[model samples]
Target: MSEGVSIFAVGDPAGAQLNAAIRRTLFVLGEERSEVWNGVLQAANALRWRRMTQPQPRQFQTQQPLIDDIVRQAKRLRNLVSDGALLDLIAEAAVAVGETDSPAGAVLLQSIEEVGTDGCVVVASKAAARAGLASWLDEIGATVLVPSELDTVASTAETSYVVAPPSFMPSSVVTAPMTPEVTFVMPAWFGNRSLPSSAFGGHAEGQIVIKSTVHTIGDTTEPETAVAEGKEVADVYFPQPVWGTRSSGEREPTSDEVEACKVLLAGGLGLWLDDGDRIRSLDPKQPEGARVGYEAVKGIVPGTYLVLRQGETERGAMYDRAVIALGARARGILATQARWKARLDERLQLIGSRRAMTELERLGVRSSGQVRAWADPRLICPQRDADFALLLDWIGEPSHPTYGNAITLRRAVYKASADLRKELESAVGRADLRALERDGILHLDLPREGFRGMIVARVLAKAPFTEIVSRHHVRVPFTDGSAQWLD
Candidate 1:
């Protein structure tokens, strides 16, 4: 490979000096260096910059951890700096710069040693310039220039190195050399302008760019070749499931359900058991004794039982809260209290008082007066005043006392609707209805009970019948079926 100079643009001055010292020590030892040097440089830059930017006493305190890291790295490299006096001087200078409160002058002095055999032109920052480190550097045969004197530097000359802050390093310093080698020592609070792509030879092939902040080596050649080869390998061997087949009882989801499930996943909603072990322990008799909970729809396994709230009374306090938690986006779908009352009155008128009372009695209504009130449009319906759970039991179609599958629940919803499929589509979108064809499925995204209950309500309203007969042990039917369930 052709010789190319490496540039280290560290965020902190002390960190830059430390990195230069480590790289120089590695070079002197004549051991494999670039990888180890680049790793340490990136880590040091990040830690130093973070420490400098942190609030108050934190920024002021000594970075003993960073010092420890540098010592540990040196030890890992067989303590190479101890082998030579020049390396020892560089190491001591690096430590002194890092531990000091004001490091600009110490860092600038340290940079003089990093100049190669051909020497370098140094551009001093305002702080380093005021510290009078330039005269010492110049005396050592290094051409030191202030930021204002950047234009005077002989850019056209084949210099070994050009060391400066990213802001002061001129275009001529980069493009003027046949194989330009530059090092930028960045400030703690430099403004938004980043080093140009040209500084790294437009990420050209064979160019190795080391950045301290991200700790990544941009090897332009290898990565592109790897990506191109990867595409060919993937084409030859399509991805397949690594695990065993799905359980016999699980049903594969239709394409429509998959699309709807995607939406539910995006919304972060899923079905959960209303009366799990934790919830049931809260209360045994009162329906409100326990709160409802939900799991992510994507996580529901084949055997899990999901809660289905079947109440049609839309104006309940709990129901209102649930609708509100669906977010303002659902305002168009959720009906108002007045609209609900009118719809209920019209239903009662169509059924007639006698038949309505008979249906209420069959649903287990004991009070004759309550039955009469609900049956008659003129009288206030008992449903208007009933508790949320009690209202569902009185008027809503009773769920299968044992089974909790989506197919069974959907059938119940279809039976309850006036126009069957038409009303079901109106209440729940057709796309969503198709999603309900599976067994024991529920989805929820929000943790709040209101949000959880809203998802349950939407599911109950839109559930559609499926041709699949089995419920228990039914595996989820997807193209990529696996035994492992997502938590």
Candidate 2:
């Protein structure tokens, strides 16, 4: 990439580094700015970037047990980090939707089914919009409306119900037998996971809507608490059961076991070992087949191990945090690219010359999809050459190592990020105005007021560079209103 590209310099993002990167990205995007800063700072202080200076013991009488313990600790750490990342994303999304209340757990089917009757106005914030809340309500026969649309349709509706954030609750409503009542659907960190498609009863027209939920004994209402109280954990995060080494004896895995592994991978779960540093595959169809051994599956708890080895099931979280982080990273990467492409379109429409537009159109580069067509790295545009070259290079095809062809979109993000360092570095350099802050005769860092003069000199320098850096950099905003950049 480039000499000082933060994205390249940073290695495989794990633990604090990955967490910090994500927090930075969200801060720059104007999503959960305060929350992200606080979270990043807290993580930094907590981790202290320590390293184990001791050398490893080469021999062990029962190496499997030691391996198992390390794995367990690793998994716990990974789960916490992944959970935090997902929650942050949800929180940021809630803010984007302008939710007046906490946006947690509002999209759960249970929450929707309780009130989603025909003609009932399901009031919700924009934060709930992306989680398929409206679609779920419609599936159960409810008239869904945003908080803003309630005023126009409130008087015309049959049964008035508001699903708004507490601040947006309609105060002028009556509370008689059938009057409007505000129901708060609090965000939850854990609950009964959505059942597999096959177990979701049937979607056939005229079939009775069977209200069924997968229940497990000793299951807590929240995942964080459940993870803390491990045995009491019940999370149905995986659509299919996880499978592992047969407890019966040494034998070849059945096709069913292999398929179960495939399902877990598809669901963003993977076998982790050696303190979450190594990933093991459940796929039995690989060149060496499935790598099922005592060491391979050691540190997993009994309930979770049974699910993997015997196909015995549980309804709780049984995933590595690294795996979750990878999935999140994949999604974040693609979303950033998509947003960048969109901004390019917006920029072109405003400033692109007629000839530039025509040339781009001739090459079928009007949109992001078309931008992918001109894949030859050496190709250059006669106009908007920088943007055209960037889109070609930035948009890439990435495939997951385990799932092969299954997760194309996720891999795209992974692959693009893999190759994005140079572009990001270039963008950062383009954005830097430190040179302007210093005298040509005596180069040095500028003071605060001098920096302001340089900034005023070129306001336009910020926009395009910011857009490009945002596609790759995580910018952590500070209390002083400045940001720390990371990849």
| Candidate whose TM-score is highest | 1
Candidate 2 Cα errors over 4 Å, as ranges: 1-116, 127-131, 154-179, 187-487
At residue 32, give the lDDT of candidate 2: 33
Root-mean-square deviation of every model: 24.2, 28.3
> Candidate 1 lDDT (Cα, whole model)?
0.33
Residue 65 displacement in candidate 1 (angstroms): 0.8
Candidate 2: how large is its RMSD?
Answer: 28.3
Over 1-487, each residue of candidate 2 has an lDDT whose tens digit, in order, gives 0111000011111222222333333344343333323333322222211100000112201122222332333344444453455344333322222212122222333444554464346554332231234434445566655544556553434444333223323323221213233333321222222212222226556543212222222212332212232333221211112132334343322211110111111111232111111111111111232212122222333112111211111101111222244575545544444444444444444544344345555555544322321221111121233434443433332222312222343344344333332332332244422222110111112232212111111000011110111110111111211111100
Residue-level lDDT of model 1, residues 1-487, one tens digit each, is: 1333334323444444443444444345453434444333333443433222221122333345555565555456445434544334344544665564433333434554655423556554322231233334435666655444555656443333334334344444444433344554433323222443356576678764433231122121221112222222211011111222223234432211111211111111222121111110100111331223334433443323333332222123233444444466334333232233344345455664456556656655544223322322211223222321243343442333211222222233333321222322223332232122221133333333332332222221111221322221122122111111111
lDDT of 1 at 406: 22
| Model 1 CA deviation exceeding 4 Å by range | 1-19, 26-62, 79-94, 103-487
TM-score for each of the candidates? 0.21, 0.21
